[model samples]
Target chain A: MQDVKAHALLINEVGLHARPSVKLTQLAKRFAATIEIAIAADGPWTDAKSPVKIMRVKAAKGETLYMRANGTDAEEALRALADLVNRKFDEE
Target chain B: MGEQKNVGIVIVSHSAKVAEGAADMVRQMVGDSVPLAAVGGNADGGLGTDVGAIMGAIDKAWSESGVAILVDLGGAETNSEMAVEMMPEERRERIVICNAPLVEGAVMAATEASGGSPLDAVRATAEELMAN
Candidate 1:
């Protein structure tokens, strides 16, 4: 099983609040892989498909988030989520 | 075959503004696809749940998939139960009253509903918030 990983900074001013967390989880649900995210470099990983778990990470702007995906679509999942975060969730 | 059923949600709170705010939050998460309604206060427009209003909102949010009601307090729960009992027997069978935080529960439940989950699954998702 080849797991994929990606890391990106949260540039959105509010980080993963309600709306952003929702967007993140919604995207995560579209993939068949199991995706997880961690805030600190050595922090515990939480389920990416759960909005509550994503919110609990308390990610803030300028902090890096670690994402890992495992399954048939692990690479795609990691790439998409990393891209979303890099885009600052499309926030202005 | 018919399209997948989209479960519905109703938010019940003691204050109208509170209910509306929670509904707005759920809308932000689930977008405009899910059926959702917020009912709060009483006939006089003060704090407390109104059974009539709850029933009305339920009707507005009715669907073949079913409906889940999330309440704020004990009184809201009691009144929600009463409102559910007053609903037609057929409809009552598909309605579930969930004891969860108003805002979080509404958001989670609405998200589940938007995914075309069944009534019980949506209710269970909302109630899961109580454990965390």
Candidate 2:
């Protein structure tokens, strides 16, 4: 099993709200890894595949989200999630 | 059994705004994949449940997987049952009036429906809200 971690800034104007959280969880489910995300560097990590948990994080714009993954596809999962957050979830 | 149809959800409340608001929350989480409709307020836009309005919303949200109806209060429950009875015999069996909080039930039911869950599973998921 592989383990990977990364930190990405939420640049979207609306941050990680309802729609964006759904997008993140849907995308996260596509991976074959155990993914978790946290709003603060040292904050408690929650399951990334759960939209409810992701929404609870309530990470605002410019806030850093720390992500961790463990599984066969951990590296791929972390890479894609980091890119999604960095791109502001492709929002205007 | 190969291509499964997703269950549909209906939000029934005494207030139109409450029904729409709950449906909006479900939309935000599940997007447009789930078939859901909000039924509330009377024909005159007053605070009451309309059997005809509920039936119409059910028609819009109809699916082979079935429809799960979530009501706000007591009267809404009775009205919803009457609305279900008014449905066609074939469609009536698939509809379930869940006993759960309006907003929470709609949200859970919509999420379960989007996953292509069957009628009973969707209704059970929403009704499970009372346990929490």
Candidate 3:
């Protein structure tokens, strides 16, 4: 399939804060893909699959985090990942 | 004790990082479509009597639905139980404490519920997240 690439917002009250960051990391690991999040100026690219990695950047709500996943099922992985962040990690 | 009717997921552990890690995994597997709330603690958050943090999670989730609290016990199991015991009996009934706990269980249950109604998902998925 094609690679999954999209931008999502962190609308949760806490923002990309810690919880959402952690969720993004795990999403990257799920489908055997490379996932990365950029808060603003190009990355601050953490594992995107590791909460620790994502937490490095302090993101607040309403910020745009761009995510991209590329792998075998990169397209599917990206859809789910993008949907998650776009949906404010579903906490919204 | 009224039985679960719309539930939220809560995770408790001495290590917030561990709890956070579990949360991440669960969220990925569960999808962000669900309505879930989580609160964690360090050992100092009251590892022994840390039910407050989990309770807080329940309260947060309560805004959306009932809650199922998951505790990651190292030596804190006893204290965790005590914390839950401290809750008002009425509130206790609304919350289910699963000591068979895995950080994943909470996430799975919460995630499944986030997809829609949590009562059935919590009961079914709480048992075997990997299976479902």
lDDT per residue (tens digit) for residues B8-122 in model 3:
6666666766777877766665555444555555446643335566555556656335566666666445545665677778766656666446665665466445434446446
Better of 2 and 3 by DockQ: 2
Taking the candidates in order, what DockQ does each have? 0.36, 0.19, 0.04
Off by over 4 Å in 3: A1-92, B1-6, B31-35, B42-49, B74-76, B99-101, B118-121, B129-132
Measured by TM-score, how close is model 3 to the native structure?
A: 0.46
Candidate topping lDDT: 1
Off by over 4 Å in 1: A41-43, B1-4
In order, what fnat does every candidate score?
0.09, 0.13, 0.00
Q: Which ten residues in a row have the lowest lDDT in candidate 3 chain B?
A: B1-10
Q: Candidate 2 residues B1-132, lDDT tens each?
A: 322377888999999999999988988777787788998998899999999999999999988888999999988999999999999999999999987789877876776666566788777767766763
* Model 3 lDDT tens row, A1-92: 55466777767788776567556654665667776778874666555654434555787877877776678877787688778867777776
Worst 10 residues of 2 chain B by lDDT: B1-10
Model 3 residue B36 lDDT score: 54
| lDDT tens readout by residue for model 1, B1-132 | 122368888999999999999998888777877888999999998999889999999999988888899999899999999999999999999999987888998898877676666788788778777774
Arrange candidates by TM-score, descending. Answer: 1, 2, 3
lDDT of 1 at B84: 95
lDDT of 3 at B9: 69
**i-RMSD of all predictions:** 1.7, 3.5, 7.6
Native-structure RMSD, model 2: 4.0
